[model samples]
Target chain A: MSQLKYALYTGCTARESTPELLSSTLAVAKKLGIELVLLDEASCCGASHLQDFDEFLAYVLNARNICYAEKHGLTMVTICNTCQINTAMTKHKLDHDAELRARVNEKLAEVGLEYKGTSEVKHFLYALVDDYGLEAISDKVTTPLSKYNIAPFYGCHNIRPSELQNESNGGENPYVPTSLDRLIEALEGNSVDYESKNKCCGFHVDLQAPETSNRLTGTALVDAIDNNADMVVTPCPLCHLNMDVKQHHAAKTMGRDVELPILHMPQMVGLALGCTEAELGLKHHVTKVAL
Target chain B: MSRKETHKKVTVKAFRFNAETDYLPYYKQYELEVGADDLVLDLLNQIKWEHDGSFSYRRSCRHGICGACGIKVNGKPVLACKQNAMELLELFNNELVFEPQSKKRAMKDMIIDKKDFWDKHEAVQPFVVADIEEHPEHETAMSIAQVENILDADYCIQCGSCHYACPALEVNEDYLGPAALTAAYRFTVDPRDEAGMERLELTAQMGSGVWDCVKCFECAQACPKEINPIEKITKLHNLQFEQKVARSNVATRHAEGFVHSIKKHGILDEGHLVAYSERAAVVKHIPEALAMFKKGKIVMPWNMPKSKNLDEIQKLVEISQTNKL
Candidate 1:
């Protein structure tokens, strides 16, 4: 029996683009004695794009996912910032709007499911800090990352448009968030503060305005370098992809020589918890893990 | 207690540049005693009147309504007239740093170019263009609910806060930006407007339109009026999908791909999504594709399995139906 359990939601980017996030998340969870019940029945939270199709349909899709968690009697914990926000947005809307909730439950009834609003959504960062105490995590740290000065990148959906996100996801100040910084401190690492820490990753516009997206992406990494940080860690895999895989594109756009290892939040935590690199699927990173 | 008892001292750093007088921009710091109720514009007024007449910035109604007091106070866009100077100092660690909007070209201290901003706003056709001949009776009354539909976008004061806060605008000058998109949304949702579809087509343009929005919430974060300009843009997308307008943008295809993939597998099929969205241009990404494949970022589409409740999800969300996204 695990001490703490959550219905894990491995968002699209994690499941498809970055499996290391899912693997490292699981590895870290096992070490922390946290049980993550895979929400196998879950569908995509629409990735914030589905609302463009049908807001009602997007709401229903997430309502059904939350209903699945309610069936398991556990909180819905997601590793992706997008998933956390999208799910939290759904919960916030359904919990507030009776007519909307009634309609959503009506659609959900077609699948023999009911969203009684029994479950809450949280990011893994929030879950770790809130439910699983930072002190507890500090106790399990076999490898303190004191040598590295890490920059904590809290991406947009995780913090901004704060009304739509879980209010307690990061911190009150969306402009200058400190939760990720505190998490870094818990792992015995120095957190370098930077302007781009809470800015957009430009991943959303990669297909639309490739060069512009790259510049915005590069700005964050460049800001990290300017802040004298060695490595960057993000709670969002989409941020990781843009910062790591597309870093060359960003550098090319900004005309700067920049190379930095971008770690998924779980991978960094996994390292601190003494999990082997192989166990955390470290081989999949685009940038060579400098550590 | 005297009035001085309530006043607190802090340092004010304002961006100083005259374009003609100064070769380069520089920050000039000054000391001031401010009160809790002092507006940022009041401080600027004091700085001009008492500290330095050389310091210059824009000011109009001083009530945050005219949208003239937009500036970057402590690295975030806020109306100088609306924001409390003391609150700003408290929020930003007891120091005030006033600069022009980050992305916009600076004209002088705390003032940026608004010509292009207004040009994009004009491009959106922000007002209603109803078929007046049909309504000879001149009855263009709308119910509260109809007005409520466009109310959020209606709250826009054209402050350029969202416009300046946007990263898309920073990188892509051609991008229509949130203020203009909110304008487009405002008219598109106007029940009385005949040009709703026309506005949609206008916003759906290739390079300079809605698709370029990085979907970052910075626009929403910067809006002083609490009007989430990004949400308005999202509504515009919803309207486009509902109308089933003929469109061929990458963003439209990307959205369609998400719908198709989710309907098929209960989750996204990344390989197919790229192919579906990029079409023949997918070949252009072969280098990055190979790199991703080497790192196991790109998975074999066939190997990806279906979720057990995929059918249940489809049954609920009706993804198989062409009616919804």
Candidate 2:
């Protein structure tokens, strides 16, 4: 029985595009003795698009997300990077701006909820490093990833917009971050060093410029591959979706077959901790990597 | 005398490259005792004056202004004049590698060829296009809110930090980097500018324009002035959407799909979002879709459960003062 529990906010992508991420996250969390209570009532946190359409609507939606998590009397943990940023950004904005909080609270009241701001919202990656302790996870590693070289891709929302996304605020980094690298080392893997580790995965802008977005993904993949990485891992399922499903497109942009498999943070951890491929739902990954 | 221990002996690997002399770039390691109060610029000056006089880097304002000392500390974009050296050193476990902001554009040690940045900025023609004949008084005639809107953006130092930090540049060289796009936005919002439409037109361009930004917010993080270039870029996106200026782009379509899906289902139906955005182009993803379907990643609409409290989501949007989609 683990004391650490969280209202798991599995963002839309995890529930839809990359269900493996959620399953793998569960498998890994189970091993760590952590309980992830689902925030099933929570809807999408606008995905950054809702902000462009209606900033207030996005705010209300995210505020409602926090409210659902607040109901559990636990900190909220998200698997997706966008979900992490959107909810945290909304919480920050509302907490800082009393008027906005009042307005959002009035809206929340309609749905039998109040914007109490009780729950601390964060990504599961941060939850592991912050609350669960890296030493605990490392100590439980039954199968060390000593033979593989992996590149950690800290997707944008995971470590960006540093003003609201600093380490203290439950983010990795706005500048270059080593949190992913530290996690990789904790798993007994040769964490590849590269400059573009914390850069955007270009998934957010993929629809706008497919070529440019593909190039962004390709460049990151090529960077990792060039650095002798066996595979790439990310805490963001949206990033995994792009790196997995859209890898062929990335190849077209780069004019090379850089087909390195992508792993969700939990899948990597789960694998290192002796979780079976079936248990982690590794088959769901469009790009298969043999460990 | 219990204070924060502020001094430490840290090893810094400063990048050394001379296009005129060296065939390849190399690092010159320096072990020095630096105070917690020392900035990156101070360290550079110390290296030049004491360690190696031949080491060259541009510095004028010594403060954060001029954007002259835009370089990468620990392989991340930052203004040497603005960032605390010891602070960054501590962040990266006391090992700092100082290098030119852009490797392809490096002219000398810590000096990049900024011609691309300037050329892109000039392409936007970042100057007011007001008609003096129609309303000359418009220059000084502006409300406080109007000035405030453009004030933060106007403070941009053009420190190619945003440019170097931008991941979009890796894909497209012609992609108008954040600093230039930021300049476009700063000028366009000015009340005196009559060429707002033209400026947006220039930026609304598909390849080398506003649409290319990957929304990483690196530009926002790298800015020493809190310019929030991503905010300006998204504002450009909103303005484009509001004005219906860039109606043909896939980005606009994607935004529309996102809004429509949220409004209809409360949660984005990923399958439908793609279907709506791509329309005919959705055929391209059929293979990918099939793969996901086999894995049960995509449960058909009937199989996928509806999100709970969607009526509340709709009500929230209905009551909130959201922009018309």
* Most accurate candidate by DockQ: 1
On lDDT, the candidate that comes out on top is 1
lDDT of 1 by residue, B16-41 (tens): 87766777888888888798689888
Candidate 1 - chain A - TM:
0.96
Model 2, B201-300: lDDT tens per residue? 8888878887788878888888888888888887887777676676654666666666666656666789988888787888988998998888778968
Q: What DockQ, between 0 and 1, does each candidate earn?
A: 0.66, 0.61
Highest TM-score: which candidate?
A: 1
Name the regions of candidate 1 deviating beyond 4 angstroms.
Answer: A166-168, B1-6, B131-138, B319-325
Residues A44-162 of candidate 2: C-alpha lDDT, one tens digit per residue: 88788767656777788899989888888988999988888889889988988898899888988887778887888888998888788789889999999999999999898878787
Superposed model 2: Cα runs more than 4 Å off: A102-113, A167-171, A174-176, A274-276, B1-11, B21-23, B29-33, B51-54, B132-141
How would you class the docking of model 1? Answer: medium
